[model samples]
Target: MHTTTEESVRGCPDCGSEIRVHSRFSAWCAACDWNVDPAPPEERPGRLARAQRAQARRHGEKLLTELTAGGTLRPRRDASSVLAYALALAVHAVTLAVAGAGIGFLIRGWGGFGMVPGTLLLALAWSLRPRLTRLPTDVPVLRRADAPELFTLVDQVAVVVGTRGVDAIAVDSSINASVATYGIGGRRLLTLGLPLWEILTPQQRIALLGHELGHYSNGDTRHGQVVATAYRSLVTWEYFFHPYSDVTLLTMTVNVFYALPRWILLGLLLLLDRLTLRGAQRSEYLADRMAARAGSTEAAAELFDWLLVSESAEVTLMREANGSALRGRGGSGRDDERIDGLWERLAADLRSVPEHERERQRRASIRRGHSVDSTHPPTWLRQTALRIGPPVPPAVVSETGRELRIGAELAGVRKTVARRILHDGYGN
Candidate 1:
């Protein structure tokens, strides 16, 4: 009574019923979400053929993973760390000597000498620490159970990669997260900022964890930590030696002689900061590729955008707070607000530029000197890199799986190291 037509009915691969497919390569049955790709096109393959193919694929994957694993620890000789330490130490020492000379002048009841420099150095330490400075926290070690919402995502990803979850994830007030390995064969610590959690989505959070783990997996954590320790050791010396310096300027005739050395010290510190930022940005890019390779492009992109937003917000809040705090402090309120304004203005300028142009500017800054002072790359470059995907071979899926495994081992090592460092001491 009726004739079938191609427009009215299409062959259903699964149920073999006449059903319409709305899109090309529609693998799901309309009535059921039955996947169709693995279905045999002809007679089902015999057991022997399937077994041999499966075994060969598994063997090949194992071999590839082993080969790549060996390459992960290859030393990436980034000289920025060495340069930064040298610069920081030189600057710090000079600044301390000048401050000490001022102290010497004060002790001798001079018209001027020690009071200003002593006040400046003391003010620098007090104003910067805990609030504005990048000092490590003395808060109790944070357990995963304490912040289940944040740590769960980290743990889930670590589980997938086969690593023990982090021992503790710190929540700094800053807008960054960093992984540190104390020394050779030491424990690792992953410091997460409270601001970062507020800005990132669950998937993005997972991707970030993956990225950090990538650094650990590739032995970047250990290298970075060794360099960081040397830097910190120098800073400690600056703090300690400033008060003990030979600033016995018992004469007002010799005050200007010390200012030059102080200025040099400040300049060197700034240079070190810039160099550190450059190395950090490159490491961040490497982590981004690792995250993407693990199948989370969307997560990485979203995270990058969120980080940019958080940074913008932080800049805004710091400016507003500084305005209120220093309203009567001789307009040194201007100094506090200057850095905030610089970042806010830079972020605004970036918004006005085209995405690609902004990316070029960011990269150029890294090449000239490290413009990003955080432990992450610029958001624009990170987002752009995610769009490009990992540059590895097409067996990238297997590589992803392998990375996951390596990440797990690395995470376990990190957690163990972190516990030791936090509970014991860095030297221990």
Candidate 2:
């Protein structure tokens, strides 16, 4: 997949040491980390941002310690959890109160100029109403009839994780996967990112599915419509009270009048964020355990290792697409042929990475406290937690023939995604 040559070797400017270049990655000195992250970190964040980061890191570390120390793995209904739910209910109550007031106004001002305020209040109430998550229409959605093998595999994993199987599977070009609920009935949807799927071993694929489905079994309240919609309502309130930008006396006076309410809303939003943060993080860890239970600890741990290289994998795909576009200028047929092999080349490139490089990336992740997001714990911690206990045998296995059938089912999606990248570029 990758071959070393004189052209691929260079001296690191910072350390003046030889650095071997990877075909899919930037050359950097592993010893000194020269150009490891070429772009500078963003400018110092605001005080609130700094505080939030600090709080998240503290929670992550605390949880890691508790897990590694033989503490309970399941989430407990602690005070924070109770308070978070109470606050969410309070948010819903406020919206209901606003709606009631709007209806009263509409009734009282039915035949007068007062109808304007009534209408405005009703509009505000409607805007704040709880919303259902909807299925994304842009991606390819495959049903049981279309991809029976894949759906069956997901069903097996769901059984292991103690959750209902997905209603449909969606394929996209991202290097990530997720499970979410949609519609008023809250039907489950599984989104599989083809880039990530192509590089993983079949068992690792099961691990990916296990991890996503585990959220459903883990009781992650953050995903519940009640809390989610409440958060959205707070965001809407903040937007409505946000200071105006127009440079005029009237605008300045209006901003001054709204400043107090804006600050109050901001406080509420931050409070809700903090209250939910711990439970969300715990859910992620519990989900990881479920992943281990479903696909085996080894497979789950390997999945995390793959995640560390996801950015590199994405960059390699983009580079390949760009190369295809450049070659297409000479002729169309050759570029089309190369585009067909994009996934194969990507899998080969990632699989061929040196162990030393993988270790370096893992260490770097620990140093930087890398995570998927603030709602999750550090990748290194998650990986470490998986290894702390005895290895688990997979409850569900991926058979070779079944895997091939699933691959055949996804062939059309793969081609469509490849062509889109070739034209629209990666991360479009």
Candidate 3:
């Protein structure tokens, strides 16, 4: 039996506060509530365990803070945002200068016409606002439950990653979700699309949300927007000053004048395209890793598959609108040169596995898969990733029948509106 004496009631040795010993081996401090125990014979927590516990505590605290809304965790993006804006603006200016200088030699009126188009392009580029300072607005929906569940997932992921809840979630029939952060000051908004709500399970959705949150947290969103804005400006400049339509018209008409210079400018446009596509592919890969880290790898893969399918649908829709000419825009053709080696390399990496071994792995993955990757890699490449593992965790599948039912109702509402508006408007 463990004995107790007046010594047992002595103050805690650790804090010099009054303590009561319940057992001979352990004492509890009344003031600090510190639990004191006899020194271990020889065993103690090692460094790794101590570090892990500390990490766990920190992670837990982070989650709690997001949930309760009393944490000091705001996205710290000052230097990166400034750098992104500066670099983007500088690049845009340089491109305009080069194009302007080139066109200046062609015009007779002191080269003022050269500057006109270039200045217009610069203005267009400057119009796309930075994503960090916009206020958020929630998308309205008849299905109230889906919104709350969506909030739950957002909250959970925000907690894990240590960020604020998403700024807004929007509903659209289009099967796509983009992670965007915009605005100038403290009013930055993060927006999500409703297509994600239809496609992703709660867990997978959280994983996806976590990826977006990662972009916001890492200041990647601001950087991406800057790049996109700059690229858009470049496109605007190209279209206004050196339009393909104008070049074609000039080739047919008496104005064979613009055709030769337009052909030369075409090379520059192609080069810019190649660079932009490469940058987009790399940025996508980084976002995928962020999702994987925050949630299951399976969810990332599923999300990728979903994205590929979604893109295919979008391509089909575009083709319907424009005709067969628009078909297979991203497949082999002029566009293939834009993606350059990315698709070919990804396809090789994914398709090189032996057939039988691949089939076995595919079967296993069907039973328990990794989530989707964010980037919509080549279709064949995505199929390979799917065969290797599930796109989402088994836990992500844990959804109540209620959520499924609600999702169905939301789908019905979407269809009803689309039938009345889109189907009628398009005369389909």
Q: Pick the candidate with the highest lDDT.
A: 2
* Model 2 lDDT tens row, 166-236: 99888999989998898988899999999999999999889888999999988777888888999899889
RMSD of 2: 3.0
Model 1: how far residue 256 lies from native, Å: 4.7
Task: Report the Cα lDDT for residue 338, model 2.
Answer: 68
Score each candidate by Cα lDDT. Answer: 0.47, 0.83, 0.45
User: TM-score of model 2 relative to the true fold?
Assistant: 0.89
Q: Which stretches of candidate 2 lie over 4 Å from their true place?
A: 1-40, 43-52, 324-338
Report residue 331 deviation for candidate 3 (angstroms).
Answer: 44
Give one digit per residue, the lDDT tens place, for model 3 in 1-428: 11122334576666897654433124445455454222222322543233333333333333334434633223343443455556567656776565555455445435466556655544543453232434433233332355565555566666665567655554544555555545544433445444334446656675676667665555443246556666565455445444334445555563355456555445444433333332333334445545665566777665655553343333433333343234445444644332233222323323332333233333333332221321222333333323332344332333576466545545544444333322222223
List TM-score per model, in order: 0.42, 0.89, 0.46
lDDT, model 2, position 198: 95
Model 1 per-residue lDDT at 360: 35
The stretch of ten residues in a row with the least summed lDDT in candidate 1 is 126-135
Q: Comparing candidate 1 with candidate 3, which one achieves the higher TM-score? A: 3
Residue 370 alpha-carbon offset, candidate 3, angstroms:
19
